[model samples]
Target chain A: MAPPPLAALHSLGFPAKRLADLATMAGLSLWQPQAGNAGGRVKPTALRVLVLLGHAWEDQVANTWTEPYTAWIEVAALADHSILELIQRARDTSLYISFTTITANRRDLAGEVLSMIGGRRRLSRDSRDNIELALHEALSNAVLHGNLQLESLSGLSVDALERFSNNLTCRITDPDFANRRIDVICDIIGDAVTIDVVDQGNGFLPKPRPEPQASGRGFDLISVSCQSFRLLDGGRRLSMRFPA
Target chain B: MDYAIDIKEQEALVRLTGRLTFNDHAKLRALIKEMLQNAAKRQILDLANLEFVDSAGIGMLLIAREELSNLDKQFILRKAGGQVKRVLTVAQLGKLITIEE
Candidate 1:
């Protein structure tokens, strides 16, 4: 038989005692970087786990383990079971889910939603691909643009994108910005799915893309993939409907 | 994403594996710089092992194409399959880069 969950975490090199303490803390934990370990390294396995959990950032290659780590692991812990329930709820019955999460980017949440919906629905390859791509754009926009309140790339050039990415890394670590919440709601009816990603930051109107450009493609991708999409709450809420 | 580049004659072949998203920006930039320094007449990115790509990845590819075009060096994509191919197609990158079968 497989080892118990806690045992598995221990075998994976997690601090079992710390994990237990955090569990008791009920999804809240304070992390402070250990003294004399400023440049410490994270194990490869732990780094992979953090990436899969969406807790690692793009610019964290060298500093993967350099900073203090704090997380409410309840969401990460539910990967296995939540994945199954997500699909079952969509297939066997109507499914409605609303999740509110801190501003830290949670790409896994979007990945989970897509995987579950794909498993339950018999969508054509094109349709499935479109939905996955569109959903990713939506989630990215919600986190980077909405909650983080960062402007999209000013130009398609490499320099511009690099600057945007660097700014993102710094902004996500700020409590004033990182503490904001992104609300995701998914409603599945029969074979169709509608998802709304709402953010608390000030919203903006999407300008028309008169030509091919680097930024602002999020709206275009969503429009092409879904049957219809509307910007509501002055762009704070993006609701997209994918047809069966 | 992770990449390995092989140089043969005037052409450079790069094999990319793993998800290519915003996370790979720095690595991708360094790789592009390396490709530019090689002074190869042509560069081909092979994506058969690539599993996923996001909008930022697409933009990076465009940047590569534009930079190469400025140097009059040929840049092409090869062997993209599965989701990677789908995303490339959706982004209409074929209008700017050569995709080889």
Candidate 2:
């Protein structure tokens, strides 16, 4: 029989939505267990694998042991043997690397990503690495929320979108769409192009204070990197203009 | 990853021999949580047999350390070698967690 905690994760995430994103951020997986048990104890390793794979979330790993020592043995044994790949190969700066990850290997997407650099038909190798780094954030967010199926994934989805929140200049200030995992639909008419990205995951929630941890820097990549950007209606939906 | 642990009275020595990574987060987190929950805070994590670490593995370790700290405990990582230590250092997590090489 499966452990009880796994049931909780199933409610949060399943079937997995953004796979490439999860692979980019938070990393693959790991394991943990108690000290020792009598013997033939139930294990929790399988569930963790599911979460890292973007298959599960919120569910705790299951364990069974009268004593603690045996459980730890099982846990440690399972944990001490995995080495994930250091870098991803797909982050090349050829065309627009704009999945839910990068906006433009050429144009700047804003917030935790880089802009698409246009000039030479080819891009220099040095600057291309930054695109990978930037996209890593978006990729991370997409996978993190999507995999966990947490309510926060919604924020990564359409959260933090703020349009004309500042002055009533009809200006928009939504989260950077270039790098984040938003649902974007673009319509091109003559010299004008209309684009929209809709993030499929948990919506936004308030950021909570916590101890020191790495910053989730998806929006930053798009905002700073993108040339001209704007947020619309609490970052729910936004639009950008690029000259042809 | 597999392990052989020796619990002598107050000290529970866990010998971890493998490459900790994403493939094992679930079990590892539960086991570590249980260890911190039921045993002494002064736990020995013997990584002599450890080989490599990924982001998931590192995150698990950090989480364990934090959770243990709440219990006024310390997870002593012993015998972590060459490339393994380098991975921890690059992640900057080495600064927070105890390591012996």
CAPRI grade of model 2: incorrect
Kindly list the per-residue Cα lDDT of model 2 for residues A1-244, writing each as its tens digit: 2112211111112224333343335353223333451132434222222222111111221212111111111111111122012112111111111123222111223221222222211334433333333333333333333322222211210111111112211211222332233333333234433333334344432264254342322354433323344545443333443322
Give the lDDT of residue A225 in candidate 1: 80
Clash totals for all candidate models: 0, 84
lDDT of each: 0.63, 0.38
- List, for all models, the DockQ compared with the true complex: 0.30, 0.02
> Which candidate leads in DockQ?
1
Report the lDDT tens digits of candidate 1 across residue range A85-154.
Answer: 4323222222223333342374455665565465446778777777777778887887788878888677
Q: What's the lDDT for residue A19 in model 2?
A: 35
Which residue pairs collide, candidate 1? none
**What tens-digit string does per-residue lDDT give for candidate 1 at B1-101?**
89999999999999999988776888988888888788689999999999988887887887787777778889999999988887788788898789987
